[model samples]
Target: MINKYNNSNKDVKYLYKNFLNIGQVGLLDKFDFSEDKIVQAKKCTLYTESGREILDLTSGFGTQNLGYNNDKIISERIAFANNNELPFSRLFFNEDVAKLAKKISSMLPGSLQYSFFSNSGAEANEGALKLAFKYHNGQRKLLIHNKDSFHGKLIATSQITNSPEVYFDFQSSLETDCIDLSNTDLLEEKVLKNKDNIYAIIIEPFSASLARPIDFKTLLKIQEICNREDIVLIFDEVYSGFFRTSNLFYFMNESDLLPDIVTYSKSFGGGISSVSGYTTKEKVFTKAYGSQKDALLHSSTYSNYVEESRVALKALSIFSNTNFQEEINQKRKYFIKKIHEITNLKYVESLTGDGFHWGIGFEKIKLLNLDKLLKLLPLEITKDPRFAEKLYVSSIINELYRKYNILSYAGFNSEIKLFISPPIIISEQEIDHAVESIIKTVEKKPLVLMTSFVQNYLLRFLNKN
Candidate 1:
């Protein structure tokens, strides 16, 4: 049985040991959080084993959009538990699953009327890939993916991802073409060059790592190209989905382009269950898996999990409310303003992103002879290399957690950006406190920042060993 522990140092050691045993030692060392035990989370604040309160700006990497321990959503889960509902089998029809499917299909704007439920963003992308490939009758040879776009870590998605350094060992079986979505000329050139062999062009409207919206003209141009080439256009909205982007979907209120397929997972389950899905048009579905024999072809045990389905349905209902969206918008405006205030600091390069999702980027100050030292590192250390930007971002993340008790994320792109994805329900007071804490965190003495860098370097050295 899982029981809460009030022990501080002892619990931390046990957790670290278990993390090491699970091969997550490097991940734990990388962040180097000041406090290692979180016993409970209430709304936007996390409570430690010692009963210290820490603001959770990470929002579980944007999954806890509605915040933790949400009573309303939890009540739904309690009801399901009381009913003692059995897990739905793939071979049989489930009313709750069918209701959720209809609700999702009808809720999506535009022509996206079909959806396939799964357990993760990666699984959803896997489903999307299978559909895209099958729709073309298996003749299309290449998938055009954008730079800095993170679709998933699965086989097909990993191959198409631009962040090869992060997935060095998990190599892709199929060849893929890459293009920078920010450069319109380069994007058109690559797409047109590989249009004949391309099955689909997948991208995020605003990639979380890049932390900026893609130019609308570029999206329109890609859409036009995909239309002319008969290639499916897919949007990986796993991170940018829900009202996280100030829009229901990033492509909804922001752009006029309608993608053939869209995948979402992060916030869709209301932070209560593991659920994800991909939406597509009826024609695309018909072409891909319309026949009776093919209907059950792409499925897994967790595809129709009843508990997750019920929670997802409730979450969708919550997201559909207009009043809740307006309240989120109100909070988002204040959140952006508070973040903007911190950008005035000398170390801060800029703040980028939309709505409640933003990243704080630091000014890049080159270290002398760093590249030479990096070159001398072992081949295994060099294989899935971490760049200067990622290290700098990691330092900032560590400093924030250590000094201010605010959890944040570090971007992995060429320019490291510290990400904040606080719950939309966070109050203006909480926002002010977080901003003030960050201001102090960023304004730390040069010696403090240097120590953070040293800690990071030592961790990397340990990783190398």
Candidate 2:
């Protein structure tokens, strides 16, 4: 198989189609203006092989919060290459493990003393659940998670994801926690009913994709319930942590409420390293894996990585700087004020989220005879419920990329109308350009954008295929 296209097929597209993933190509195929080969990236800008300079607003889905190729973050990786020294090992006593654990513990709430490292959000979540089960000594039978919560894709975590698309939730495996936070009593009822059997309840404090935060009032109530019921409360801040949403942690903005375990990844690696971790209270850590006998029980081979630790340490320092936060705050206020103005448009139905991430629900404004004209197409593809949404969003995204060279993304799940979450490091000029591009794109008639998109997409598709 390797020999079939080893040297004969040097095309990157061909390599992806044959050896890599065909789905990735299929996903990108829908976006005509997507860069095929990005040659360089620094700060909020991406340089492509086609000599195009794109302003990246998605921040690699919240991984590159410090911006791409950050000088400070990159220097750590460079030092790692130059020195190549092993800072610590998983087997014997590890300095990085101790240092990072202590460092994160100091910044967070006083009780969140111990930490465990992993490779990704899902792994961190899986570890969190394992810790909960171990804390209960495998006596508990249920794990609770919020509806529409995306903890991870690993089988255990997937069971609680509640995603209908890629990560289909095994509804029967895990118990549903709460959805209608407005009902106030809904969470308490479930927690009380399952208190004896529920080991842990996972929650996403701020969902960046949907641009929604679990209400602070509801969170305070959950904290009270968890304290009384002995259920481990886990806050999965994979995509929302590391000042991606203006605050160091979403929960920090309002009042002080700590969870039993907090799983974090994404920007924790400083946009370069792959590191995820869960910090838990000392009691939870000791009760779960206190003894040396169970210490190695729930550990990954890649956990406690020294290079990753070095990167994370540097990233943490960068995040802790007062000047850095001040600059980001100014940009954040500008972005919020600008995005808030979009709600005035009749097309925008709802607005959620805050800081750098926002989800705007758009409703179609019926045209005189555009539907009739669209119905005449070869297939009535517009009949799907999401067709209008996809049309409006995809068109806007494509236009932004093509005309303004700005990159943005749609929210996740079934009802993803629009998600606008740019990198925190984005400049005022870039924000102005990106927001204006979106406004102009949305202002266009859906039919007009669709026609242009189809033609351009076909042109690009034909040029490549």
Candidate 3:
């Protein structure tokens, strides 16, 4: 079968109807926004087909931390590609992999000495789960996850994901028990009840659900409980890893506790489509590597892809350089200060998140209307959901894309949660542009409604009694 790239609006619609049917086209089709609206991106800015400049606020869902078309990264990748490096090779030693492992080990605190690479976050989590089981000799069987937390999309990780939508299709396949992140009492009770059976307690240190910091005290308590129960504490830091959270690692600066296993992806690849790593204590590897057979027990085809490792090494090098963290902190402080100033809108419940990853809660928006709008637009186009809490978020990503060209990901099925995670490399001028765009978008809804009849229809659909 020949693969065709859909460029025109008619082509996209035709392909959507003919080729893609079951796949959810949340934001792409709903808004009726044309591909022409997207300005091909270069560096940090995106240009529309009409030559409108858009300051990217979402950072391609927080993957492009180094920004779009980073010259250094691009050049490095080009050099690697030109050299004809084999990304996948069985039974071979790659120098790039060793270099990346060395670089990662150098940055990590304590004895997180080993690195295992994978293609995506889910694959990394799968490796961690298998390693945890193998380390404990399979005596532990239960995999505990926090409620409403996202880990990955693979079977094992999906089983542990708290989102019902993620598990909606394969509910029967999921076999893990979930506990509410906020409920300390239940957590203790569950751990006690299944102490021997529980192999790992995996958590997203900074939860995307509320875009809030995990309670430090509760986290420490959970750590203690895990120690007492002999359960492996796994921190899934795919979304909050790197220096994106202002801290080098989410668990390092924010909480005193440490996990036995930590999985990282997304930004770790340096905006590339490959690379993921799991850090574990030496003992875990020692136990797993007791024999040669055990060493080959868990491995991926692309476990140590050279190009990805090289990118990861370079990304880490960039992260470790001085001034990166300071710049991130400065930007975060400025953003928070500006966000606090915009309190005129009554729909915003609270703003939460760390470093570059933040969420706006809409406590006062109408959920039904928000759902209708979301149904009509692409998932990235709108942030509001049906929940009263979601409505109060009082922000429209579509307007941001329209006036300022800043694209953000809006939450689904919830009342209100808008994720804003830009690259750490964003300049102050870009930051100012993003903030101004947000301000303009929030204040200029009337104008937006005037331009798009869809917006007017959505408003009327929302206002109907």
Residues 59-110, candidate 3: write the lDDT tens digits: 7776788788777777888888898877667668888888888888788777
lDDT of 1 at 48: 71
lDDT of 1 by residue, 388-432 (tens): 555456666777777787888776665567888898889999899
Which residue pairs clash within candidate 1? none
Model 2, span 1-465: residue lDDT tens? 012223332276667888999887666776854444676788998876667888887888889889999999998889988997785566677676678888888778758889998899999999998999899998887877777777777777877776544454344444445354435488777666766887887888897656788888888888787788898989988888988785888887765688999889999999999999999999999999999999789987789888898899898888888898899899899988888777776567888887888888877645444575456443555665566567667877888888888888886475665777777988888888877777787777777777787777767767866
lDDT against the true structure, each candidate: 0.79, 0.79, 0.70
Top-TM-score structure, candidate number: 2
Q: Please identify which of the two predictions, 1 or 3, would achieve the higher lDDT against the true structure.
A: 1
lDDT of 3: 0.70
Report clash pairs, candidate 2: none
Model 1's TM-score against the true structure? 0.89
Candidate 1 — which residues are off by over 4 angstroms?
1-23, 30-35, 368-391, 452-465
RMSD of 2: 3.8
